[model samples]
Target: MTPKAKAATGALTLASAAILGAMHLWEGQRLTVYADKLAGGLPTYCSGRTQPPRPVGSTLTQAECDAIDRQTATEYGRAILACIPAERMDQNSFDAMTLFAINVGKTAACNSRAAHLMRDGQRENACRALAYGPDGRPVWSYARGVYVQGLQNRRRYEMNWCLKLATAA
Candidate 1:
């Protein structure tokens, strides 16, 4: 790789690591939380082996859960980096994409409009795309607009991080 490309890759790697750290700080390591199936059906404790999916009628200690969380998130972050192959990324964009990849999957993250926009050098638009749901709409609620908010808020936070708050520090 050229020096500039190598530099961008290094920056992205650093930013992704920071992003994962921040994610753990925010979410904590849940020993048993149901995640939606990657193939898209219902939310379940078992989605894939990449995540520390809890088995049916199984129990786990805090240490085990934490280890699994770190492992899974690291794997997802690396997948995100791999998906972007030759693209140059800013720190904020890298952080946003890393977090998004961890939440969504590598396939979705790689194929997202946000990813396309980033690749096309329309980063501002890519940040906006982070707020869009899989349906390509902005408002996504877990419940019936009451008692619970959802991924939209998370997406908005990511958008803000990418567009304004994310930094090299």
Candidate 2:
């Protein structure tokens, strides 16, 4: 892969938006209302580590969302750079891990199986790590005191993308 692809800074930015869209947080900044009627605010540009700061009525414009998304990606990208050596992983793996980091929080992502695998030059397994739980069980994550499958699906998609990159030298 080229240096640009290995860095994958642009891919990370785009993937962050994709994750938000998949979670139905793409209509600007608004509350995510699940099928079960559970509600939670998910800001487009996350000022907080876990979620965006709740806006007035939990809403924001497209431009506002775009700005926040860029800022958040930059913030998370820096965190990813701090721990994970930039050249150690390919673009697909780095991008997937960065997106996961953005969703799961940088602190957790940096300490995750994916991070460990990548650091040890096990890029393929790093991508696969996204599909498993912290303990290698079924993928599941808690949100608002309830388990949500959105994360699991997102991780799986990322895992596939990372795996498609093929083995590195």
Which one is best on lDDT?
1
What are the lDDT figures for the candidates, one per model?
Answer: 0.61, 0.60
TM-scores of all predicted structures: 0.67, 0.66
Q: What are the candidates' C-alpha RMSDs?
A: 5.5, 5.8
Encode model 2's per-residue lDDT on 42-150: one tens digit a residue: 4333323335335434445656655666666556766876778777756566666666776777899899878888888888878888887557764525567676686
List candidate 2 segments past 4 Å from native.
1-52, 56-58, 133-136, 144-147, 166-169
Worst 10 residues of 2 by lDDT: 26-35
TM-score of model 1 vs. true structure: 0.67
**Per-residue lDDT of model 1, residues 62-102, tens digit only:** 67655565565556656666766535566777777777776
Superposition TM-score, candidate 2 onto the true structure: 0.66
C-alpha positional error of residue 130 in candidate 2 after TM-score superposition, expressed in Å: 1.0
